[model samples]
Target: MKTRTITGVFFIIVMLASLLTGHYSFGAFYLLLGLFCQFEFYGLIKKSGYQPNYVAGLINGALIYIAFAYTANTHIVQPVLFLIPVTLSAVFIQELFKKSTTPFQNIAFTILGLMFTVMPFTFFHAMAYVNGDFNFHLPLGFFVMLWSNDTGAYLTGRAFGRTKLFERHSPKKTVEGFFGGLLIAALAGYILSIYYTEIEWKQWISMAILISCFGTLGDLVESMFKRSINVKDSGGILPGHGGLLDRFDGLLIAAPIVYSYLYFMAT
Candidate 1:
């Protein structure tokens, strides 16, 4: 309990500070996060009887993140998208020399790593520039809703959880907890609207619901992968919180949805 509490507090502090500091801090933080997730993901895949071109995958992931970050920062859509295929092509070329039996699977996982890990992080970075300027409100509000949903679910699950939400993938989550999370996340959205009035309460509430539903699914998806790989946690970087992927699984699924919501709102 003590370890979890301490890690959670420090994690929150670093996250908030990064978001609040400026674009540089935010970009660096998520860039490193995406790289770590790719590393851990390839590690797991390798453990499951496959070689996933870890070096090539990491390089590709890093380039994808940099392309998005650069565009978000400079407000210019450069031809950096070309760099992705260029980097990914290296994986296929390198695979031919490795003599691995599952070369095609190796290439597939390498590309999938970018989609699974780096793309969502790119969406997350875009939240900071929702209005063509870097204001802390949109991203900050997004995270506030996420945290509220997580807290509400945990508390409600412990208090009144009976029926399983997804018994096969995640046995501990309950239907009651899902609704409880939505309710509290909606409240948090309303609170965010009070201060960060750029987006209205209705939209914020809608986003909260989306976050809750998809975030829980994201957690279950990660569990499914870990179960398939015969592992407990993704990694032990967080002491009690598992790996970066374990902690940000919710963000992985929720960020793209929230990004789409914000983009449509802007359009």
Candidate 2:
């Protein structure tokens, strides 16, 4: 318990620092984070008796993230975007020579790794520069609400949780906890509106609803991934937290949706 609390605090501090530092740090930090998460995902897939093309996947992940980050900042897609398909194509071509029995399975997992981890992070990194420049407020607000929801759900579920939310994926989650999380996230959004006036309060609350709903879904999805593999945690890199993926699973799914909302609103 003590180790978990300490590690949690350190993790939050590092994440906040990465965002608050500047655009370079923000981009660099998340780029590396996205890669690490992808690597971790590949590792897990290997444990399930499949081999994903790590080289191709990582290259593609980096290219896609950089391409999106560049476009988000300048509003002009770079020629580097061209490298994505080329790298992706290499995944299929590389599998042809491996002589593996499940070549298509290898190919599928390779691409799935990109879709599961890289694409969402590309959207997330782009979110920082959504308004034609880097601004941490929106991304920061996202973390705040996400954390609020996680904390609220945990507390509420412990106190009054009677019905399981999804017994198949996550038996511990309850419907009551879900609503409690939504309410707390909404309150956090209202508070964010008072301080970060880039968007309306209602918009912030709406975003909170999205994060709460999708963040929970993300957690369940990761849980399902683990249960399928008969694992308890994603990885043990963090002493208390399971892995980078475990920590940011909520962000993984929520980032894309929130980015879309903000992008449409901005345009």
Candidate 3:
């Protein structure tokens, strides 16, 4: 327990520092994290007895992060978005080099892993790229909101949880705790909204609810994968939390969705 808490704090500090200083440092930090997560994902898939192209998976994950970073800094849409199909074609062509039992299956797994693990990180870039007039606190707001929802749900669920949120995927989650998480997130949103006059009340509430709901779903999704793999945690890199992937799964899911909402619904 002590180890987990300490490691979690260290990870949070790293994240806060990187996010607070948005530019090349932030982009590089996120890129590194994406690489770590992609490596872990590739390792997990390999354990399933199929030989996914590890290099291809890393390249794909890096491409996704590149798209995200470029989009955040300016109007430049990453050409990698268009290059995915071309890249996949190359992966297919390379499969002929190896006489594997199931080459197509391996390639499919690699693509699915990219979608599951790398795709959602686009939200981080989107959050970094809010309108120029906004203050430095814009990105911090995202971290606070997400952390509040997670903390609120965990504490609330432990204290007064009864009904399960998703028993099969996440047995420990309770519907009561889920609402508690939402309520706390909404309260945090309302307070933060006052600072950012550009965002309306509805938008704040929407962000809060989306984080609580989808963030919980993200947790469940990871749990499902872990359960299928018959593992308690994704990796042992972190003491209490599990791994980098475990810690960031909710953020990965929530960030992109919230960013999308803010982008499309803006006046």
lDDT of 3 by residue, 1-267 (tens): 888788878988988888767577777887787778777877787877878888877787887678766766766676767876776676677789989999998888778777777766656655666764323455677667778888888899999999988899888889988998889988888888898766787788788888888888888888888788777777878877777778877876787788888778843
For candidate 2, the lDDT comes to 0.90
Name the better of 2 and 3 by TM-score.
2
Candidate 3: lDDT of 190? 88
Per-model TM-score, in order, reads 0.97, 0.98, 0.91
What C-alpha lDDT, on a 0 to 100 scale, does residue 179 get in candidate 1?
92
RMSD of each: 1.2, 1.0, 2.0
- lDDT for 64 in candidate 3 is 69
lDDT of every model, 2 decimals: 0.87, 0.90, 0.77
How far out, in Å, is residue 185 in model 1?
0.6
Better of 1 and 3 by TM-score: 1
lDDT of 1 by residue, 20-113 (tens): 9998999899898888898888888988898888888888888888888888777898698787777778998998899888989989888888
Query: Residue 193 in candidate 1 has what lDDT?
Result: 86
Mark the regions of model 3 whose C-alpha exceeds 4 Å error after superposition. Answer: 78-82, 132-136
lDDT of 2 at 92: 95
TM-score of 1: 0.97
Of the candidates numbered 1 and 2, which has the greater lDDT value?
Answer: 2
